[model samples]
Target: MDQHAQRHGARAARSHGTVEPEHGATTAARHPELAPGTSGMKGRARHIPATVSLPIITALAFGCFIIFRTHTAGIKGGPAMLYGLAGAVVSGALGLVVAHFQSTLITETRASAYGALFGCSLGWVYSLGGEAILKSCAFGFTMGAVMFVAALYVFRTHRTREPHGLHRPHKTHHRDDRSHRLPAATH
Candidate 1:
């Protein structure tokens, strides 16, 4: 439990070789000087948070702002803000439903395209005013497919390059084999 043991990543033993609690912390790594985040290339990208979800928050906040703005405009009945609220709520719902399959921006764009298609189908249904089976499926399908394809194409072609700043020379264990060999043969 002393600082030497902590810096050296040494483990105390119970009856078995199982590591003691003191050594189980991250400081016990072989290279104990390296912090968890900066240890290597693998460590950095593993911890990005859900900052991408802020758009949903913005949509809902804008919806609320619109409702207040409309209310102040002498609206006594159904306000124009309901459309904003509907857009915000529906888009958020769609995002939530689709996010399960989307692990990155590229995949999320495809999901958003799907949501757009769904929303258009809903709009087509609404245009019929509660009638049965008259959606503009062709238009929605074409648009959604086009968008998804375009997004994927861009992601594939314009992919970001690997960072060069962190590059390191390849590691090798080869040593002078001649020094370990027998003496030269004498005729």
Candidate 2:
């Protein structure tokens, strides 16, 4: 009947803390700081730290060994082994470089491109027989970029949320679900 009540329907006149939430609705207080607002851009760019770099390099090197070593049939202590070892060493080294320059905020595509650059470098050096310069460079570009962005994306998405006063109380919760959840006997 009153102006305040009419304006807010049934609960407009209620105090800020009194407005209860409806069913299944959570208060803003319960949610983590989300985006689209100021400071919503939580993403940041950074190089892979020392702790991560070594492991990444090691993984790539091991992969190179797996790939090249198994293929060379009986080339014991021969050019094949030498080349495989060399390729692994170079790949590992390039991985380190990729880790060092790995930027986070940069689009993952660009980051992968960066990684591909490093990877292709090794590919070109060892691909002496028939691989063309353009082909190797393209390969390196793709590999470097993919590697850089993938690493960054994984790291960025894995941040453990810190629960620091994140949620806001849902106004409708008190009025809707709670009222219904009451046992019929209690009602």
Candidate 3:
């Protein structure tokens, strides 16, 4: 019976892609890079330098603003160019600041900052679309509040999730039903 149980255990471990060696070290312990969360850490921490990130951010902002000015605002020529340039400059500056502060700030705080920026940008665009100052203010405030709450919730939820790729044993519950057994009938 013991040998049968041992064989079953070994088979289960083999099926699970894990083996308990005699030395009692897990495969992941021997190769930390193969371990759950640590695998991505080294690769993920490779930061984009500010020079490259800024230009990419600026280009994207410029393209978006040019599209907005031409399609939505019906602007053309020098004015559109200037607006696009302005957007590029603003986004570049914002990107630099974000990059600088990213390492220092908590995830929730960074999320809030991004949310507030989005709300402010939306409010500015709304005002440009002929809305009154008070209405724009109210809209921006509402959006900012919503964003703050959403960001907080998202960061909290994301932080609580376990990192994947770890092998964990599943637990099973066993119940004894001896008390509920019926008496054997005589043939």
Highest-scoring model, lDDT:
3
Off by over 4 Å in 1: 1-51, 57-79, 104-136, 158-187
Task: Tell me, by TM-score, which candidate is best.
Answer: 3
Model 3 misplaced regions, further than 4 Å: 1-55, 58-71, 160-187
What are the RMSD figures for all models against the true structure? Answer: 16.2, 21.3, 16.9
lDDT of 1 by residue, 1-187 (tens): 6698668878666565556656454453544336655666555445444434544674576456545554555443464456557756765665555544444334446446655745463444333332344454655555666666775565455445312221233655456656556798999
In model 1, the clashing pairs are none
| Candidate 3: tens digits of C-alpha lDDT, residues 12-75 | 3544555455435457656656667775766343455754666566557655765575546666
Q: What's model 3's lDDT at 158?
A: 65
lDDT (Cα atoms) of all candidates against the true structure: 0.53, 0.53, 0.62
Candidate ranking (TM-score, best to worst): 3, 2, 1
Residues 8-114, candidate 2: write the lDDT tens digits. 66543255545455523455444323323524333221334563657466756655663465355444455655665666666666656555554432445435654
Pick the winner on TM-score between candidates 1 and 2. 2
Worst 10 residues of 1 by lDDT: 160-169
Clash tally for model 2? 30
Candidate 3 residue pairs in backbone clash: none
